[model samples]
Target: MSNLPTINTDTIWAILQDKISDEVVNQLVWSCLGYIYDETKQAWDISKVVDDWGEKYPEPPDFIANRPPTVKLTRSIPQENKQLLKEKLGFKGYKLGEFGPRETRRATAANWLLSYLETH
Candidate 1:
Protein backbone atom coordinates (compact mmCIF):
# COMPACT_ATOMS: atom_id res chain seq x y z
CA MET A 1 0.00 0.00 0.00
CA SER A 2 1.11 3.55 -0.75
CA ASN A 3 2.05 5.21 2.52
CA LEU A 4 2.59 8.78 1.41
CA PRO A 5 -0.20 10.09 3.64
CA THR A 6 -2.24 10.58 0.50
CA ILE A 7 -4.23 7.39 0.70
CA ASN A 8 -5.66 6.13 -2.56
CA THR A 9 -9.44 5.81 -2.73
CA ASP A 10 -9.13 2.29 -4.07
CA THR A 11 -6.78 1.36 -1.25
CA ILE A 12 -9.10 2.61 1.45
CA TRP A 13 -12.43 0.94 0.65
CA ALA A 14 -12.23 -1.68 3.37
CA ILE A 15 -10.70 0.80 5.77
CA LEU A 16 -13.73 2.98 5.22
CA GLN A 17 -16.32 0.63 6.71
CA ASP A 18 -14.50 -2.05 8.62
CA LYS A 19 -16.08 -2.03 12.05
CA ILE A 20 -16.03 1.75 12.08
CA SER A 21 -18.50 4.58 12.40
CA ASP A 22 -19.96 6.33 9.34
CA GLU A 23 -18.14 9.52 10.22
CA VAL A 24 -14.73 7.81 10.37
CA VAL A 25 -15.36 5.73 7.26
CA ASN A 26 -16.59 8.70 5.23
CA GLN A 27 -13.77 10.97 6.31
CA LEU A 28 -11.04 8.40 5.72
CA VAL A 29 -12.55 7.25 2.43
CA TRP A 30 -13.06 10.79 1.16
CA SER A 31 -9.62 11.89 2.26
CA CYS A 32 -7.98 8.92 0.58
CA LEU A 33 -10.23 9.16 -2.46
CA GLY A 34 -9.44 12.86 -2.69
CA TYR A 35 -5.74 12.10 -2.93
CA ILE A 36 -6.31 9.55 -5.70
CA TYR A 37 -8.54 11.86 -7.73
CA ASP A 38 -7.58 15.46 -7.02
CA GLU A 39 -3.95 15.07 -5.97
CA THR A 40 -2.63 12.24 -8.12
CA LYS A 41 -4.65 13.23 -11.20
CA GLN A 42 -6.98 10.24 -11.26
CA ALA A 43 -10.67 10.26 -12.07
CA TRP A 44 -13.36 8.53 -10.02
CA ASP A 45 -16.82 9.07 -8.56
CA ILE A 46 -17.16 10.44 -5.03
CA SER A 47 -20.91 10.11 -5.14
CA LYS A 48 -20.64 6.50 -6.20
CA VAL A 49 -17.96 5.95 -3.59
CA VAL A 50 -20.24 7.28 -0.93
CA ASP A 51 -23.25 5.38 -2.20
CA ASP A 52 -21.29 2.21 -2.75
CA TRP A 53 -19.86 2.65 0.73
CA GLY A 54 -23.30 2.24 2.28
CA GLU A 55 -26.59 3.90 3.14
CA LYS A 56 -25.39 4.49 6.70
CA TYR A 57 -23.62 7.56 5.43
CA PRO A 58 -26.55 9.30 3.79
CA GLU A 59 -24.01 11.84 2.57
CA PRO A 60 -20.51 13.15 3.17
CA PRO A 61 -20.08 15.65 5.95
CA ASP A 62 -20.34 19.37 5.13
CA PHE A 63 -16.83 20.15 6.46
CA ILE A 64 -15.07 18.29 3.64
CA ALA A 65 -12.37 20.29 1.86
CA ASN A 66 -11.56 20.49 -1.85
CA ARG A 67 -8.53 18.42 -0.94
CA PRO A 68 -8.97 15.23 1.10
CA PRO A 69 -9.68 15.53 4.81
CA THR A 70 -6.72 15.26 7.18
CA VAL A 71 -8.27 13.54 10.15
CA LYS A 72 -7.57 9.80 10.02
CA LEU A 73 -9.84 7.77 12.28
CA THR A 74 -7.67 4.74 12.91
CA ARG A 75 -4.43 6.37 13.92
CA SER A 76 -6.08 9.25 15.64
CA ILE A 77 -9.08 7.64 17.30
CA PRO A 78 -8.54 5.82 20.57
CA GLN A 79 -9.73 2.27 20.90
CA GLU A 80 -13.01 1.23 22.61
CA ASN A 81 -14.28 4.64 23.54
CA LYS A 82 -17.90 5.22 22.59
CA GLN A 83 -18.74 8.72 23.82
CA LEU A 84 -15.40 10.16 22.79
CA LEU A 85 -15.84 8.56 19.41
CA LYS A 86 -19.31 9.98 19.14
CA GLU A 87 -17.87 13.41 19.81
CA LYS A 88 -14.98 12.91 17.40
CA LEU A 89 -16.20 10.60 14.64
CA GLY A 90 -19.85 10.85 15.47
CA PHE A 91 -21.96 7.87 16.51
CA LYS A 92 -24.11 7.61 13.43
CA GLY A 93 -23.78 3.91 12.63
CA TYR A 94 -21.39 2.57 15.26
CA LYS A 95 -21.61 -0.98 16.55
CA LEU A 96 -19.78 -3.26 18.95
CA GLY A 97 -17.59 -6.25 17.95
CA GLU A 98 -16.63 -7.44 14.48
CA PHE A 99 -19.29 -6.99 11.79
CA GLY A 100 -20.70 -9.82 9.69
CA PRO A 101 -22.27 -9.94 6.25
CA ARG A 102 -26.02 -9.29 6.32
CA GLU A 103 -25.65 -9.45 10.07
CA THR A 104 -24.83 -6.30 12.02
CA ARG A 105 -26.02 -4.09 14.82
CA ARG A 106 -26.87 -1.48 12.27
CA ALA A 107 -28.99 -3.32 9.73
CA THR A 108 -28.70 -0.56 7.13
CA ALA A 109 -24.93 -0.56 7.29
CA ALA A 110 -23.14 -2.60 4.58
CA ASN A 111 -20.25 -4.95 5.31
CA TRP A 112 -19.09 -5.18 1.71
CA LEU A 113 -18.96 -1.45 1.27
CA LEU A 114 -15.60 -1.05 3.04
CA SER A 115 -14.08 -3.77 0.93
CA TYR A 116 -15.31 -2.17 -2.29
CA LEU A 117 -14.68 1.46 -1.33
CA GLU A 118 -10.98 1.16 -2.25
CA THR A 119 -9.65 2.07 -5.68
CA HIS A 120 -6.55 -0.07 -6.01
Candidate 2:
Protein backbone atom coordinates (compact mmCIF):
# COMPACT_ATOMS: atom_id res chain seq x y z
CA MET A 1 0.00 0.00 0.00
CA SER A 2 1.08 3.62 -0.53
CA ASN A 3 2.74 5.32 2.45
CA LEU A 4 0.05 8.07 2.35
CA PRO A 5 -2.41 7.44 5.15
CA THR A 6 -5.71 6.03 3.98
CA ILE A 7 -8.39 8.76 3.78
CA ASN A 8 -11.00 7.77 6.38
CA THR A 9 -14.48 7.22 5.00
CA ASP A 10 -15.94 7.72 8.52
CA THR A 11 -14.36 11.20 8.82
CA ILE A 12 -15.85 12.12 5.44
CA TRP A 13 -19.15 10.73 6.70
CA ALA A 14 -19.05 12.69 9.96
CA ILE A 15 -18.54 16.05 8.23
CA LEU A 16 -20.96 15.30 5.38
CA GLN A 17 -23.65 13.85 7.66
CA ASP A 18 -24.44 17.27 9.19
CA LYS A 19 -24.71 19.05 5.79
CA ILE A 20 -27.00 16.28 4.46
CA SER A 21 -30.09 14.79 6.08
CA ASP A 22 -32.53 11.86 5.64
CA GLU A 23 -34.35 13.56 2.73
CA VAL A 24 -31.17 13.58 0.59
CA VAL A 25 -30.24 10.29 -1.12
CA ASN A 26 -27.58 8.22 0.72
CA GLN A 27 -25.80 7.43 -2.57
CA LEU A 28 -25.37 11.16 -3.32
CA VAL A 29 -23.62 11.74 0.02
CA TRP A 30 -21.26 8.79 -0.42
CA SER A 31 -20.58 9.71 -4.04
CA CYS A 32 -19.79 13.32 -3.13
CA LEU A 33 -17.40 12.27 -0.37
CA GLY A 34 -15.78 9.64 -2.60
CA TYR A 35 -15.20 12.16 -5.38
CA ILE A 36 -13.69 14.64 -2.91
CA TYR A 37 -11.43 11.98 -1.40
CA ASP A 38 -10.31 10.70 -4.84
CA GLU A 39 -9.38 14.20 -5.97
CA THR A 40 -7.68 15.47 -2.76
CA LYS A 41 -7.33 12.48 -0.41
CA GLN A 42 -9.54 14.50 1.95
CA ALA A 43 -13.23 15.20 2.61
CA TRP A 44 -13.06 18.66 0.91
CA ASP A 45 -10.82 20.30 -1.69
CA ILE A 46 -12.02 23.92 -2.11
CA SER A 47 -9.66 25.47 0.47
CA LYS A 48 -6.74 23.34 -0.72
CA VAL A 49 -7.32 24.38 -4.34
CA VAL A 50 -7.55 28.06 -3.28
CA ASP A 51 -4.29 27.80 -1.27
CA ASP A 52 -2.51 26.20 -4.21
CA TRP A 53 -3.65 28.89 -6.64
CA GLY A 54 -2.65 31.64 -4.16
CA GLU A 55 0.91 30.27 -4.10
CA LYS A 56 0.96 30.05 -7.90
CA TYR A 57 -0.42 33.59 -8.55
CA PRO A 58 -0.24 36.03 -5.69
CA GLU A 59 -2.37 39.21 -5.32
CA PRO A 60 -1.32 42.39 -7.13
CA PRO A 61 -0.29 45.68 -5.46
CA ASP A 62 -3.80 47.08 -5.54
CA PHE A 63 -7.25 46.55 -7.00
CA ILE A 64 -10.17 48.65 -8.15
CA ALA A 65 -13.68 47.20 -7.80
CA ASN A 66 -12.03 43.83 -7.13
CA ARG A 67 -10.04 44.02 -10.38
CA PRO A 68 -6.37 44.81 -10.96
CA PRO A 69 -5.77 48.23 -12.50
CA THR A 70 -3.89 48.73 -15.77
CA VAL A 71 -0.09 48.97 -15.45
CA LYS A 72 1.60 52.39 -16.04
CA LEU A 73 5.11 53.80 -16.45
CA THR A 74 6.80 53.81 -13.04
CA ARG A 75 9.03 56.88 -13.58
CA SER A 76 9.40 59.79 -16.01
CA ILE A 77 11.49 59.01 -19.08
CA PRO A 78 14.28 61.66 -19.42
CA GLN A 79 14.08 64.23 -22.32
CA GLU A 80 17.17 62.76 -24.04
CA ASN A 81 15.86 59.19 -23.61
CA LYS A 82 12.42 60.32 -24.78
CA GLN A 83 13.98 61.87 -27.90
CA LEU A 84 15.87 58.62 -28.58
CA LEU A 85 12.66 56.65 -28.00
CA LYS A 86 10.83 58.89 -30.50
CA GLU A 87 13.59 58.26 -33.09
CA LYS A 88 13.39 54.52 -32.42
CA LEU A 89 9.61 54.60 -32.78
CA GLY A 90 9.93 56.69 -35.96
CA PHE A 91 12.17 53.98 -37.45
CA LYS A 92 9.44 51.45 -36.63
CA GLY A 93 6.74 53.69 -38.23
CA TYR A 94 5.38 54.76 -34.82
CA LYS A 95 5.20 58.54 -33.96
CA LEU A 96 4.27 58.08 -30.24
CA GLY A 97 2.36 61.41 -29.90
CA GLU A 98 0.88 62.94 -33.06
CA PHE A 99 0.43 59.54 -34.78
CA GLY A 100 1.13 56.21 -33.10
CA PRO A 101 -0.29 52.70 -33.13
CA ARG A 102 -3.64 52.57 -31.32
CA GLU A 103 -2.51 49.34 -29.68
CA THR A 104 0.44 50.93 -27.83
CA ARG A 105 -0.44 51.62 -24.18
CA ARG A 106 1.61 53.45 -21.53
CA ALA A 107 3.13 50.27 -20.10
CA THR A 108 3.98 48.86 -23.53
CA ALA A 109 5.51 52.17 -24.62
CA ALA A 110 7.60 52.33 -21.44
CA ASN A 111 8.68 48.72 -21.93
CA TRP A 112 9.74 49.45 -25.52
CA LEU A 113 11.81 52.44 -24.37
CA LEU A 114 13.47 50.42 -21.59
CA SER A 115 14.18 47.52 -23.96
CA TYR A 116 15.79 49.90 -26.48
CA LEU A 117 17.98 51.51 -23.78
CA GLU A 118 19.03 48.02 -22.55
CA THR A 119 20.04 46.83 -26.07
CA HIS A 120 21.90 50.01 -27.10
Candidate 3:
Protein backbone atom coordinates (compact mmCIF):
# COMPACT_ATOMS: atom_id res chain seq x y z
CA MET A 1 0.00 0.00 0.00
CA SER A 2 2.97 2.31 0.48
CA ASN A 3 3.95 4.54 -2.45
CA LEU A 4 7.64 4.34 -1.54
CA PRO A 5 10.04 2.46 -3.81
CA THR A 6 10.62 -1.17 -2.89
CA ILE A 7 14.07 -2.13 -1.59
CA ASN A 8 15.98 -4.85 -3.48
CA THR A 9 17.01 -7.55 -0.99
CA ASP A 10 19.25 -9.22 -3.56
CA THR A 11 21.23 -6.02 -4.07
CA ILE A 12 21.42 -5.52 -0.33
CA TRP A 13 22.65 -9.10 0.10
CA ALA A 14 25.16 -8.59 -2.68
CA ILE A 15 26.46 -5.42 -1.01
CA LEU A 16 26.57 -7.19 2.33
CA GLN A 17 28.31 -10.29 0.95
CA ASP A 18 31.89 -9.04 1.27
CA LYS A 19 31.69 -5.27 1.52
CA ILE A 20 30.62 -4.99 5.16
CA SER A 21 30.87 -7.22 8.19
CA ASP A 22 27.91 -9.46 9.16
CA GLU A 23 27.58 -7.76 12.57
CA VAL A 24 27.11 -4.30 11.01
CA VAL A 25 24.55 -5.57 8.46
CA ASN A 26 22.64 -7.40 11.17
CA GLN A 27 22.59 -4.32 13.39
CA LEU A 28 21.34 -2.07 10.59
CA VAL A 29 18.66 -4.55 9.50
CA TRP A 30 17.49 -5.03 13.08
CA SER A 31 17.34 -1.25 13.68
CA CYS A 32 15.28 -0.68 10.51
CA LEU A 33 13.07 -3.65 11.30
CA GLY A 34 12.48 -2.30 14.78
CA TYR A 35 11.39 1.07 13.42
CA ILE A 36 9.08 -0.59 10.85
CA TYR A 37 7.50 -3.12 13.22
CA ASP A 38 7.33 -0.88 16.28
CA GLU A 39 3.71 -0.01 17.17
CA THR A 40 4.35 3.65 18.01
CA LYS A 41 6.83 4.88 15.33
CA GLN A 42 4.52 4.08 12.32
CA ALA A 43 7.32 4.87 9.89
CA TRP A 44 10.12 3.21 7.89
CA ASP A 45 13.02 4.60 5.90
CA ILE A 46 15.08 2.04 4.04
CA SER A 47 16.79 4.72 1.91
CA LYS A 48 17.98 6.57 4.99
CA VAL A 49 19.28 3.36 6.50
CA VAL A 50 21.11 2.47 3.29
CA ASP A 51 22.54 5.97 3.04
CA ASP A 52 23.83 5.81 6.60
CA TRP A 53 25.33 2.43 5.90
CA GLY A 54 27.01 3.81 2.78
CA GLU A 55 28.35 6.75 4.78
CA LYS A 56 30.03 4.38 7.21
CA TYR A 57 31.02 1.81 4.56
CA PRO A 58 31.57 1.44 0.86
CA GLU A 59 28.52 2.57 -1.19
CA PRO A 60 26.80 0.06 -3.44
CA PRO A 61 26.35 0.82 -7.14
CA ASP A 62 23.00 2.39 -7.94
CA PHE A 63 21.24 -0.25 -10.02
CA ILE A 64 18.13 1.72 -11.05
CA ALA A 65 20.13 4.68 -12.39
CA ASN A 66 22.32 2.30 -14.44
CA ARG A 67 19.40 0.83 -16.43
CA PRO A 68 19.48 1.63 -20.14
CA PRO A 69 16.87 4.06 -21.41
CA THR A 70 14.23 2.51 -23.69
CA VAL A 71 11.83 3.95 -26.21
CA LYS A 72 8.59 2.42 -27.49
CA LEU A 73 8.36 2.69 -31.30
CA THR A 74 4.63 3.27 -31.05
CA ARG A 75 3.66 2.94 -34.67
CA SER A 76 4.19 0.61 -37.56
CA ILE A 77 6.76 2.36 -39.71
CA PRO A 78 7.74 1.60 -43.25
CA GLN A 79 11.38 0.55 -43.64
CA GLU A 80 12.10 3.62 -45.76
CA ASN A 81 10.59 5.99 -43.19
CA LYS A 82 12.41 4.27 -40.31
CA GLN A 83 15.72 4.57 -42.17
CA LEU A 84 15.01 8.21 -43.01
CA LEU A 85 14.19 9.04 -39.38
CA LYS A 86 17.31 7.25 -38.24
CA GLU A 87 19.43 9.15 -40.77
CA LYS A 88 17.99 12.53 -39.76
CA LEU A 89 17.73 11.93 -36.00
CA GLY A 90 20.68 9.57 -35.47
CA PHE A 91 18.47 7.63 -33.05
CA LYS A 92 20.30 7.57 -29.71
CA GLY A 93 19.32 8.12 -26.06
CA TYR A 94 15.63 8.56 -26.74
CA LYS A 95 12.82 7.06 -24.69
CA LEU A 96 9.76 7.43 -26.92
CA GLY A 97 6.80 7.08 -24.54
CA GLU A 98 8.54 8.15 -21.35
CA PHE A 99 8.17 11.89 -21.57
CA GLY A 100 9.42 13.97 -18.64
CA PRO A 101 7.95 17.43 -17.92
CA ARG A 102 5.84 18.22 -21.01
CA GLU A 103 7.15 21.80 -21.03
CA THR A 104 10.41 20.67 -22.67
CA ARG A 105 10.64 20.70 -26.50
CA ARG A 106 11.82 17.05 -26.65
CA ALA A 107 8.80 15.89 -24.65
CA THR A 108 6.50 18.10 -26.72
CA ALA A 109 7.94 16.72 -29.95
CA ALA A 110 7.42 13.16 -28.76
CA ASN A 111 3.83 14.00 -27.77
CA TRP A 112 3.19 15.56 -31.20
CA LEU A 113 4.66 12.50 -32.94
CA LEU A 114 2.44 10.15 -30.90
CA SER A 115 -0.66 12.20 -31.63
CA TYR A 116 0.19 12.38 -35.32
CA LEU A 117 0.72 8.61 -35.44
CA GLU A 118 -2.58 7.98 -33.60
CA THR A 119 -4.52 10.10 -36.10
CA HIS A 120 -2.94 8.42 -39.11
The C-alpha TM-scores of every prediction are 0.21, 0.23, 0.19
lDDT of 2 by residue, 16-67 (tens): 2333232222223223222123345533333333213334323221211112
Ordered from best to worst TM-score, the candidate numbers read 2, 1, 3
Candidate 2 deviant stretches above 4 angstroms? 1-75, 92-102, 106-112, 115-120
Q: In order, how many clashes per candidate?
A: 8, 0, 0
- lDDT of all predictions, in order shown? 0.33, 0.30, 0.31
lDDT of 2 at 83: 44
**lDDT for model 3:** 0.31
lDDT of 3 by residue, 29-114 (tens): 33432223234655433444322333332333222122211122213233344433234333343366754332122222233232
Task: Rank the models by lDDT, top first.
Answer: 1, 3, 2
Count: clashes, candidate 2: 0
Global CA lDDT of candidate 2, please?
A: 0.30
Deviation in Å, model 3, residue 34 alpha carbon: 1.4
lDDT of 1 by residue, 1-120 (tens): 133323333323333344444444444445543322344644433554432322333334322221212222222223433233234333344355655432232221122222223213
Higher-lDDT candidate of 1 and 3: 1
**RMSD after CA superposition, every candidate:** 13.7, 22.2, 19.1
Judged by TM-score relative to the true structure, which candidate is superior, 1 or 2? 2
Candidate 1: worst-modelled 10 consecutive residues by lDDT: 105-114
Clashes, model 1: 8
